[model samples]
Target: MSTQPTTDVAPSPPAPSEGGRPSDGLQAGLKNRHLSMIAIGGVIGAGLFVGSGSGIAAAGPAILLSYALVGALVVCVMRMLGEMAAAYPSSGSFSAYADRALGRWAGFSIGWLYWFFWVVVLAVEATAGAKILEGWIPAVPQWGWALIVMLVLTATNLASVASYGEFEFWFAGIKVVAIAAFVVIGLLAVFGVLPGAHSDTAGVANLTAHGGFMPHGPGSVLTGILMVVFSFMGSEIVTLAAGESENPQRAVSKATNSVIWRIAVFYLGSIFIVVSLLPWNSPSIVDDGSYVAALNTIGIPHAGEVMNVIVLTAVLSCLNSGLYTASRMAFSLGERGDAPKAFARTSARGVPRAAILSSVLFGFIAVFFNYKWPDTVFAFLLNSSGAVALFVWLVIAFAQLRMRAMILRDDPSKLVVRMWLFPYLTWATIGMISFVLVYMLTDPDGRQQVILSLLAAAVVVGIALVRDRLRASRPATASAGGVRDSAEGEESLPTGS
Candidate 1:
């Protein structure tokens, strides 16, 4: 009953720009290479670099399993997303799927919620990256560095899609290389082969000797999952960016297919090296980053500062991709009439100028909130957006279930990508995501985040329902008006035709 993959057509038409031509809209400037690195770079983020420290402390060496658990979750979600993205690539891929499979309300609500999450991400990453930069150059205030970082990336996005691709290719490349080098160098040190390095702390013994691998008990592995799970959030950016790629289906298929190894090598691989090199309980692990701490323990000079540079690279890359993602989602919403029409318009260079600026505008406000209230307004916004990853995956699972049935029913020939194990695995992924949500409700902090996210999601859903109802009623209202409406309709008809 399974249908084989097929060549994909151009993605849905881009929203008309100010010039009234589609060419003025987004261009397929992203090459396959860019797509590959974007996916790789998206998965290996600040979470693995910085957040892993807390995760190790919470669960000790067994934090690896927590990552594996979450990585499996990401793998499942990405596969489902890729199936749809490859079949019919769109900038609004998931939301569009929700629209067709679930309903416009699903699409509109999920689309806006997803956008909300990334805009908040833009603020968080900017502030994080600013700290790294401010460490090196004490002359500039942290806020000034944050502003500078945001403005630079915003301009990169506005310049053109190719510019964004080039920047990310290099940015992600550095991250890829840095982690890879760390793995190789760390392994060499572990085996006591590296030059000018001590290896007393580097061995498999460290994993068990410190705290028998599960220092905080098995409950802490779940706690570690809570601490480290958000690190996997940005892996799906490839599909969104792939809509503007030369071969959207190929790019998507490759990225989705390779996700496992990418997660394995970059995440599991580096974490394994770090833990093998130093005991999980080392105080330096938290003070410096996990990788930096491991490197310093192995006698790598200035390793903490050096890893800070790579972390800075990762932070900027995340911020750049965040702006790109939020704007495209907005543009998709505009094209579907789910958002203000201005967001749909692109510039002469095929950049969605309005969308980028608008996304950044909110980002600036979030930054202000971060500065103004560490615990009040900003905290709520942060938590409200925090739980969106699981919610999004849940939507994708359902959407894919519906999407699989649709592909099988209506157009099996267009089924270029199919979810693994069909309805069974789809349901499993859904159940797993639900479990995480319910689990969140048990922790006070997690409960606050889940509750706020739900409230926000509900508001977005309400707006979507009302907006859709008004839109649905417009034609009936127009029809009820008689000859004036007929005259208006006639006037609206294409003149030349």
Candidate 2:
């Protein structure tokens, strides 16, 4: 099979100025430290704190295998993504790669779907954060809190890319410190080294006792995958963000290389402590929530309140990143002529002011639906975007398969971050993603998400296809004279009309 793409590839936008603060494009304002912390912190989402309780209850200690399995999947996908990102270094990330490797239609479809996913995320995280703030101060209604939180983060994103990085650095810093402390403290209690303990079950015995590790059986472990898989959505944000860093390729390569340890430490490590601290079936696991329950079991004071503070920080971090990510994707789409031109323009500080505001405007609308129509409209929005992460990963895998050969044929030196096992592992990733999507049909909730998400994808793909057909039918005189200008080395367009 030919690895070369059959369709014409659009050129990449002009490179940022040498000053690293380009007025025409995004600025390289993110420091190495900012990128480092973002890579470290991106994997630690609020879902780990709030949603793991159900997974633990459903899969028992075996949930660790679920995390490990999904972690392995993400690692592979990121490797493939890193390979292309290192070579191309675009804000579009996989979407841009898809444009050159597959076709513009593929890029348009996945890019819009991904943007939809994050804007929906904006609403979900806003509500989550608002609830916490309301709890802290009842005088302010939850709706008011949501508006306040959204405005603050929107302002942060609009300030400059560096401001976003700085805020995320601290936000991610808090999450990292909190999780590290939890693991260290939990380990002390687990090994019986702590001065005081609330539960004697804080030992390895908790793993085997109460129906053994696989309490609900292997089937339950498969089901648990559905629960924990979405928590890994933000793992790819660093790749998109790399375009705004001082050294995009190096930042991307480093972040990709480190994903394994980050997941192993933050996700698997934290979950290990929770299950080990108490029986998986313990009421605390569900009642108090996983992390909070584990803390209480170890005689921690005000466990719920402590976990609340940490979860709130995680929520805010997610909101901050969601806005930044969605805007960047919109900016990339606009640059490629797939969206309005205003989206591609930047302010004096290299901020995509129109792009940021447009993305936030949609996020605000989603938030309104969330408050006004929680069950119907918001529910539809959530389910429709639910499976987008897997879709993005699948597109990335396919894009990498073609991109690897394209890079080898063009400039092999740019292959700084290569995927392991080449076509074999890439095929395996595609297979795994397909399996997850197919498996979703078995669970009622998962089935709805799969169906609606597919519907949403079909709509976007339909639009892209229609646009392509219309462009093709235009007079040759108008469409001719195109030139090959892609930094990624895509082929040239037709001659002038």
- Which digits, one per residue and each the tens of the lDDT, describe model 1 over residues 1-497? 01112321112233222211122146677888899899999898887898899888878989999889988989999999998887667777788678778887888899999999999998899889888888889899999999999998988898889999999999999999998999899888878888888768788888899869888888887887888778999998998898788777688889999999999999888999989998888898898878889888878888877888898999989999999999999987776667777776766566777889999999999998998896899898999998998888999999998777666665565567777888898898888888888888887878898999999999999998887777666754353323122111211101111
TM-score of 1: 0.90
Q: For this target, which candidate reaches the highest TM-score against the unseen true structure?
A: 2
Q: Show the colliding residue pairs in model 1.
A: none
Question: TM-score, each model?
Answer: 0.90, 0.93
User: What's model 2's overall lDDT?
Assistant: 0.86
**Regions more than 4 Å wrong, model 1:** 1-24, 476-497
- Provide C-alpha RMSD values for all models, in order: 6.8, 5.6
Q: lDDT per residue, candidate 2, 1-58, as tens digits?
A: 0111232222236443332211226667899999999999999999999999999999
